[model samples]
Target: MSMNGREKITNKKRLKPAKIVWQVIVYLLLITGAIVMLIPFFWMLSTSLKESFQVFSFPPKWIPDPIKWDNYVLTFNSLPFGKWLVNTVIITASTIVGTLLSCTIVAYGFARFRARGRNVLFLVMLATMMLPSAVTMIPVFYLFKSLGWINTFYPLIVPAFFGNAFFIFLLRQFYMSIPTELEDAAKIDGLGTVGILWRIIVPLTMPALTTVAIFQFNGAWNDFMGPLLYLSKPDLYTLALGINFFKSQNDVQWNYLMAASLVTMLPSLILFFVGQKYFIEGISLSGGIKG
Candidate 1:
């Protein structure tokens, strides 16, 4: 055989082994990552289905022998689970709507307007995101108290209508990424700023808006501290606060608590999966802007 033909044969043999090695490596990494990410959820499900004793077993049982399907029933029966779920749904939905409307308006102003001190104000708003919620909790509580909003859903829902700094910043970044030429063209066609924003920018930014809605929904739904602090009445308690009420210093129901948690997480999970396309697009747009 010629030297060139021999070299070609050797290269082919080397390439086959390298391809196989890379394929094996990829599969190994994927399996390892899958196991790591799924372990917590698997544990949660196992505990939810297991008898109370099996939940805290030293050896850690992956599967329950006789699943206690009754735990879910017991959890709902023990508390006003239905009512709590309803309250959470109402608050979450209201918060999402309010946040989106308020944040989009604020973000549009920051992204499109050229008012004096606009950049400075935007920077100040961005700086507020760095301030911990814990730091402002007491002040906000006091402010709401003065307004007699305590023990009502107002504290949770009303603030959302005022806009959240972080969400506003996220949306502003996305808004800034939208080309200015479109707005200018609309202006030339007798569309005012508000008209252009409503007819053009908002429709174009639906993905980012949906992303903001999803995040706000999850945040409001999962919020424990704010609801716990604001709502003193059991009737107004959100799902998070309701779950806390299930626990006592003397005794606790691990199975029921886990079941409740699993239930509470379902809506956010469903929303995320449903809005994943818009969420991904929003994230991409967020990365494309400044502040």
Candidate 2:
């Protein structure tokens, strides 16, 4: 071997340590971030298991002695928690279905259909996202009241049947990534627009749909204001409203409230963990537009 080749090999060997150092730095940052995020959840769990007295103790107990299993029981027994859970499930399921159906069809049109004024309509829809809920809250409330929809689930579930701007945009970007040739070939085989969408486009975009479903599920499940405004009856109450009512009546019981919060949070946590693969893939694929 030449002298220059021997020196080049030595230089490559020296570069390996720099690469290792950067990798170690990245790993340390990730671990620090993970710990920081988990601290609040850990504290909540610990507080739930503790006695009321132990919650505010001087040193702050990280573990409870008896590990109050009864907090969960008391939380359920104090109110109609089971009924609240059922109501939340109904609202969440309806939103997921409505969002997926409406958003997918709208996005398909925006991605594929060529029509005049299409871009204007899309920009108008996107502009709506800038309008905060506070701006529309009073008019929306009055509209529902005029429809005699107060104290019913109609106000909560019905609006999702229309498309959401953000979900439509996400799905549209994902749909644009597919080659136009596939769509053209489908048409050549005598497939109608709806037929092609259902048979080919829908299957290809399941990841994006899963992302939409998870987002809707989280939004509906955690929604407190919508139910508080519309649902006055205890029987029709969702977990979010019910938990607030419990807090008000009980006069601030931390252990019980934490337990209830954890129960309310479980379904969302489970759904995200289960759908995370598709959820992440969908976000990445839909994050940009293609030429």
Candidate 3:
């Protein structure tokens, strides 16, 4: 072999071990992170299956010896879990529908339409996201109270119809990423602006819409403060609020609480897994797009 060939081979040999070592280190770090993330869930599951006494036992049992599966049954019987589930479903479904309808229109306009102050208006809208929720909470609550929306689902579901800044920004960026040629083609086919948006833009931006739906669903489902502030009647309580039934001044049902929490989290977990592909694609498109 030539001297140059011999030198290249030596360099490759030296680099191979270094690359392997880096790969091993990466894999080890990933595994460690996976374990750390999963430990709490595993503990929740273990506690849900164990007798109350086994939960705080020394050395911490990773598995239940007797496996008290009745914790779930008892939890349901002891609380209004079914009613809470229905209320949550209603709020989440309504919020997703409202968010999609309102955000899509607002984003489509921001993405496609031209006006003198459009850019200025868009900047103002984005600025609202920087304001803390706490800053607006009291005023918003007072406004809802003035409208007699307090102690009702209206306060929770109605605000969603107004659209959110983050979802609008996400959908707008993704919409901007779509080729303008598609809109021109639709227009040449005699489609109006709204028709073009529905037929061309919407179909092309399904991933972004799915991302919005998933986010709104997760938000409404996990919202404790909104439900607590707006909903006073027990019948109107969401699963997030209903979970507190396990708490009392005298005693807290740890096993039942864990079981209920796991059950409540299942829907969000399933939703993310089901829409994960579109969610990731939407995020990539939204981030990659520019004015």
Candidate 2, superposed: residue stretches over 4 Å from native? 282-291
Q: Where is the poorest 10-residue window by lDDT in model 1?
A: 282-291
lDDT of 1 by residue, 36-139 (tens): 99899888888888888888888988888898999999989988999999999999999988998899899999988889999899899989998988999899
Q: Please provide, for model 2 over 212-235, each residue's C-alpha lDDT reduced to its tens digit, 9 standing for 90 to 100.
A: 888899999999999999999999
Q: Pick the candidate with the highest TM-score.
A: 3
Ordering by TM-score: 3, 2, 1
RMSD of each: 4.0, 2.9, 2.8
- Give TM-scores for every candidate, taking all chains together and pairing residue i with residue i: 0.87, 0.93, 0.93
Q: For each candidate in the order shown, give its overall lDDT on alpha carbons.
A: 0.86, 0.90, 0.89
How well does candidate 2 match the true structure in TM-score terms? 0.93
Q: Where does the lowest 10-residue lDDT sum fall in candidate 3?
A: 281-290
TM-score of 3: 0.93
Residue 219 error, candidate 3, Å: 1.1
Considering every candidate listed, which one attains the maximal lDDT?
2
